[model samples]
Target: MNIGVIGYSGDKNLEPVKSLKNICFEIGKLIAENGDTLLTGGRDGIMDFVCESAYKNNANVVGILPWDEEGNKYLNTTIKTGLDFSMRSFVLLKSVDIVISVGGQVGTALEILGAYAYKKPIILMRGTGGWTDTVTKTLIEDKYLDNRKMVELYQAYNIEELSQHINNLRGDVNL
Candidate 1:
């Protein structure tokens, strides 16, 4: 199985950085131990940290980059396969069996939409940043994900809880 990690960008803060790094390591370790591959956008911030951790853990890590040229090298080094991010969203969605959305921005929102369309399992890590706080509102207030035949939404605030919730959703095709 492949677990994709989605997060925000251009965000720089000591606590957020520390949290992202820790979550990256934990997610990498979990994926390695569980014999699952790790996937991400492979950019700076959370994507970079997680990709680095996955590489360190010797797990198969794929980076779906948003660029086609020599770009975002800081995080691209750890990626096993680097695909054009915008053009390869379909491949990324198909590559991952489950998606763990840590934090988000516009790109992350689009990732969520792609995952939803593909009928994949998604775990939302709340309080991280970006659209995390707006997920419940988006689904309930806007009915974005309501009454869907497939697609599971699990909200968590930390890496441990997020991991557990993902494990719990291993059996359910959708939430």
Candidate 2:
């Protein structure tokens, strides 16, 4: 499966959280070990950490860029989408089976909303800060995004929970 990870890009003078970085590494490793491909925005911050770790573990890391520029070295394939940031995000989400948000600001929130609109499953890593915690703890009715329940939203407070969620999805089950 192609799992998409969206989070703080650290491009707006915001610093990357220490714990979130560790979570990104572990998440990448887990995805690779599960024989899944990792997809990201193809830039720095969370994207770099996850892609590097996944690539080191012999996973196929695909980076979707907002521009026609080169991506990080760890990516096995770099897709220069030529679209702007917001447009690139929709493309990324549409191409993935599942979406995971680490710590996010405006950009990540947009991706999550897009995923919901696309009816793609979403897993939010809680306690990492930003929208991951906000969206998981609030704005969700039970595990649904809205009255329509566009898609089931999941929260993973730790790596174990994240792994279990992935496993359940692997079996074509919804949590």
Candidate 3:
């Protein structure tokens, strides 16, 4: 299985949360141990860290760049596959049986939305920025992630719990 890891890039003045990066690495390791490939944005911050960790553990890494070759010069050479973002999201989510949203910005949130729209299994790492906190919590408070449609919405505070949830998911018609 390929688990798509999503998070914000710590570029220039922006910075990703420390706890988020740690969780991403831990989750990356678990994906490796399970012999599953990992997919990410293919740059620095969460993407670089997650892909590097997974690579160290001998897991295949796929990088979906938000831009073309011009935008990927900063991307790590560790990626096994680097593709354009517009075409990549569909391919990335389809290739993965599940998706884990780490620390993110609007971009990561879009990935989550795509995964959900496709009926793919999704795990949101709580406490990260973007839709991770705002959207789901509101939905949970308003009673959205608790019904039959929620068979695909999963949330975890840490990497271990996320992996456990992935291992336990079953009977879903998609992903």
Best by lDDT: 2
Q: Is candidate 1 or candidate 2 better by lDDT?
A: 2
Clash number by candidate, in order: 2, 0, 0
TM-score of each predicted structure versus truth: 0.78, 0.93, 0.78
Give the per-residue lDDT digits (tens) of candidate 3, residues 43-79: 6777766776788888877776554432223233333
Candidate 3: where are CA atoms >4 Å away?
Answer: 12-14, 17-19, 70-87, 140-151, 170-175
- Cα TM-score of candidate 3: 0.78
Worst 10 residues of 2 by lDDT: 10-19
Q: Over the stretch 1-175, how does candidate 2's per-residue lDDT look in tens digits? A: 9899999886422465544677888999999999999999988878888998899999999999997979888999999999999999998998888898998888988998899999888899987788877776556565976778878888888999999998888766332
Pick the TM-score winner.
Answer: 2
lDDT of 2: 0.86
